[model samples]
Target: MTDHVDVLIVGAGLSGIGAAYRLQTMSKGKTYAILESRAAAGGTWDLFRYPGIRSDSDMYTLSFPFKPWTHANAIADGEDIRRYIHDTAHENKIDQHIRFGHRVTRASWSSDDAQWTVDASTDDGPVTITASFLYLCSGYYNYDQGYTPEFPGLEDFEGEVVHPQFWTDDVDYEGKEVVVIGSGATAVTLIPSMAGSTKHVTMLQRSPTYITALPQGDPIAGFLRKILPGGIAHRLTRIKNAAIAIGFYVFSQRFPQQASKFLIGRARKSLPADFDPKHLTPTYNPWDQRLCIVPNGDLFRTLRSGKASIVTDRIARFTKTGIDLESGEHLDADLVVTATGLQVVAFGQIAVEVDGRKIDSHETYVYKGMMFSGIPNFAWCVGYTNASWTLRADLTSQYVCRLINHMDARGYAFGMPDPAGASGDAAPLLNLQSGYVQRVAGILPQQGSSSPWTIRQNWFLDAWDNRRADLDEAMVWTRQREVARAG
Candidate 1:
């Protein structure tokens, strides 16, 4: 089967839906359809069903700017986030344009016609879709499987071992001793949530991660919502949240000692006086790997109440009942949850070919963090590592729409970044030291040493550049051969 459209969007997740909305409003009369590999709309929200699954970033900034997030909790649950995404799609009538169960496998660009021929696998069979522009909002993580480190004697363990990425409703941990192996955001979330039902929850970690507590609902946002119009309130709240988040990130990078002290002091106050502070304090500086947020100090309160505890140690191997530590200690666990980390996959693992030539992602350079160097009519949405991801997602979508509009007005069929030099000496694309990021850093594209090619982590800069910057500055625009010949 074959279908044709002006724009072909991959993924019907938060970014994809938002991209569709931008095209609908900004680039009117443009025919576009969203291809979702999953049967549902929400991407990460739908995939993760772990206990106490919630947003690491506030919803005001995480949600689409056009849609008002009227929910009371700033830190919303996964279900709520999923519902919000679905509601946005339904409200904008974007859901009707989405073809679910379409897993895009390959995309090939033709300079002769200035079009993309996308191949996808579906339950029915293989289908081909062509479009003038290809927008990848599929995100950078693998949906089918998460990062699972090879552990010795993992198969010898008798009890159930689960990863938060594939959590199921039927996996029972009621009144049982559960040991969650990880110190990341997922571990912090699961410890407190599972502690309510489990007899005891032990958070076993290789190293401690920075844990910070914020209120579930923002009091200022709540006040604004009551006094101002829904849209006004949402905008104000988003700005406030974004400013605070950016300020903190900047402060952490500038003054690591002060930020680390402040973060450790906050964690210490949340826990009991007798509790050892080493487990809550990370060796690395703040914002080094993401700071884990637990609303209302729930994790600390759980620890203080003796329902849960944290153990920072190396895992030697898995035993019959639990994991054995390198320090000659063993944890008794009935159920083990590996909240380890995720496996990052760029562009949904889809193969890209330009005129019968396969594109190696590592060989290319990232253009303004959205589009790739020398790759025409293609852009991917990658969010900030330090702040809310949706903030960047929103900006990138708008820029894409603007680019499309610009090409249409200028009679240009192809647009791609033509970097001055190869990015062989450029910095890592992500600039993150997280396990998942480090594991795949070599495979992903590199960010240039200068502007227009280097990806900025600052939301304010990104917002400005996306909205006002001239695309022609770095991008090379061209007319299709047939069109040029006819002209």
Candidate 2:
């Protein structure tokens, strides 16, 4: 006897939970099971325990469309986000379908059987299950460990060293000199949150990144919630915030020089007069990499108050007490935090095979920003890099449900994207030039140069396009009897 489901989701995070809800509502009577690698849900929100862990995007867009975010703050903390995910799961009874500690290692699709044979390792033993369709919502990063560069003479440092991904309660920084490496979101967040308690906090970056400030709470949302219904207010706010984000991204891309001036000018106003303008300047234009957001100008406030500071220089090596910079400056620190970046991986590093042939993701093209070329009955849930992740994630989930329903209506057993059906040169799946993305560009999948195949970062355009997308475009469908007869 073998356990089976109509659909199998690989994660229990925001995307997975949302996908489950969509499947249940849009594709009714579809039996599904969620496999979570960790003991708990909330994926990224649960894994990252560092101080000041909060969403870079507004909660209105970050949250699921089915569930309204009732919190007053638009920029929510990690714990709140985790609680929201759990509540969504419990409310929809989706939690009942999740199998914790079940890490999926491989999925093999058989055209003859018209199903996927999935294998997973668990605390109890190896578990095997079969599904008609597979939805991968496991996220893009390496969860086993975060990326930490090999610093010269790291062992020589006498101070406590830590990575934001692995922050623990026992690693105290109270009244201690802290040096945080990398000027990304984690570094900006850690500096402001830890500066007040620590004796001094310093952000050490190899180069500057574009940083900006946003209000923690949305005044318009607060006003709307007071007047309109919860659902209506949430939808309006989500749309408004999403549009603003898309507009800004477009503005930055269309007018780089003006956007750069605007960003730097805003930062200068927030900082002290004597602060060096050079430290705030970045070599690249705006939107070249993701922008760092500090809620309520907290990072700038910390800098102005003399509680925290920023140092831009290349690291020569780690000394006995602290770091020796290439600029002949030695910064003393009692603790060092490597806020380098995340290690990007495709499909949670799961080994996927079709007809006993392993999938080479690098050789495949992304179909409609979700499905892969030549892959049958599969979809990967990836979010936007420019806007809130859920904005795109919700659309992806809905689109999957639509696809499933379409297949059932036509009595199709499986559908695969055919690369020959689309005409365009191949491009990187992700358009960003960030270090983490560039590091794994060669390993990730490619996108076609035209619509349906291109992964657009604009949420507004995606929402409009997804609703009117042609389900039959560039897709090859087959019936179960046909597969069996061919075999």
The numbered model that scores best in TM-score is: 2
Q: For each predicted model, how many residue pairs clash, with residues at least 3 apart or on different chains?
A: 0, 0
Candidate 2 regions exceeding 4 Å error are 419-424
For residues 258-299, what per-residue lDDT tens digits would candidate 2 score against the true structure? 999999999999987899988899999888899889999999
49 Cα displacement, candidate 1 (Å): 0.5
Model 2 residue 392 distance off true place after TM-score fit, in angstroms: 0.7
> Best-fitting candidate, measured by lDDT?
2
Give the Å shift of residue 106 in candidate 2: 0.6
Candidate 1, 1-487: lDDT as tens digits: 7889999999988999999999999999999999999999999999999999999999999999999999989999999999999999999999999999999999999887788999999999999999999999999998888888898889989999999999999999999999998999899899889898999999998888888999999999989989999999999999999999999999999999999999999899887888888797787888878988999888988999999988989989998988889999999989999888998987789999987899888878888788888789999999889898899988998999989989988889888888343444688889778898999987898887888778888898778767778879778788655556755
Error of 2 at 199 (Å): 1.2
- What TM-score quantifies how close candidate 1 is to the native fold? 0.98
Clashing pairs in 1: none
Worst 10 residues of 1 by lDDT: 419-428
